[model samples]
Target: MTDTLLPESDAGNTSDAVHEDRLWCDNGWTARVIKNEDDDGWAVEMIKDGEAEPALVGPWTMGRDKKNPKPLDIGAFNTLVKTASEVLRRHEQQLHAQLHKRLTVESGDGSVEVTLDIVPDEDDPYALLTAFDALGEQLAQVKVAPNFKLSRAGAASWVENGFRRPG
Candidate 1:
């Protein structure tokens, strides 16, 4: 019932050989086992290529003698890569949500949609607020503070005041 994604030669090496605690460039990812600072257990970090930081870090299974970390194999490496990829994807989605927000307001003629997009730059952080009519026509666009809050009341006020920057 065991399934393996790597070639037979690679799989054989992982199972038969006694590998070191760290591996680099194995199956498009790298894994490192480090002593956990918070506890007596060991931790494993999985880092993908071209990434500055490890995408996933978690507890490592102990060896049969219960001292060193269990030798990493193709199965474990594949699983770690899958988990780390998911973590990075979720982090990106969360970051995107934090940078963009939208609100709809009822106007005299129709509904107006307001979108706030934050540009996070270490040197100069700023945001852009844009308004679109019901037909998706751009009504107004202005630069605002990065921490600017958008709401139905704010959108309505902006439209009522001739699309001028809200004070």
Candidate 2:
């Protein structure tokens, strides 16, 4: 796509910088085309501000000669930013799904909603197990190990055991 200069607000406060034919920086992100290490083709990397690694890295298009990489342009940069932002969003969603779980269990009193949320930290990982009565009043909240298993059966057992931490 042809290069299109973005509006000042969209491009942020910094002036757009074109480092080379294959690299451009704008709107707090950098798009760079590099030689593919696995193949003779080219690949593009999109890195956001203050990030040590690229949020997206994928194959790049070849130039008209089919040897050099296609030159970076405003349109290409904008597309790359959109793509890389989507990748980051999906990754965060997946991680949140993995770390948080919810279930409903039938108890003698009524149905209870149970939720297990894990905080995944490199140095200190932990989980919080919480239970709420049918009316949405919290019954109990306990800190558990990060690896604690959460399931319908486990929730039922916890409710039956007076909301005590399961061994």
Best prediction by lDDT: 2
Q: Which stretches of candidate 1 lie over 4 Å from their true place?
A: 1-21
Model-by-model lDDT, in order? 0.81, 0.87
Per-candidate TM-scores read: 0.82, 0.89
- State how far residue 66 of model 1 sits from its true place (Å): 0.9
lDDT of 2 by residue, 1-167 (tens): 33565767675544655545787777788898999999999999999989999999999999999999989876777789899999999999999899999999888888899999999889999999999988999999999999999988888998899878888
Q: Local error of candidate 2 at 84, Å? A: 0.8
In Å, residue 164's CA in model 2 sits off its true spot by: 1.0
Question: In model 2, what lDDT does residue 89 have?
Answer: 97
CA lDDT of 106 in candidate 1? 87
Q: Model 2 Cα displacement at 49 (Å)?
A: 1.2
Top-TM-score structure, candidate number: 2
Per-residue alpha-carbon lDDT of candidate 1 for residues 118-160, written as tens digits (9 for 90 to 100): 9999999999999999899999999999999988888789988
Q: How close is candidate 1 to the true structure, as a TM-score?
A: 0.82
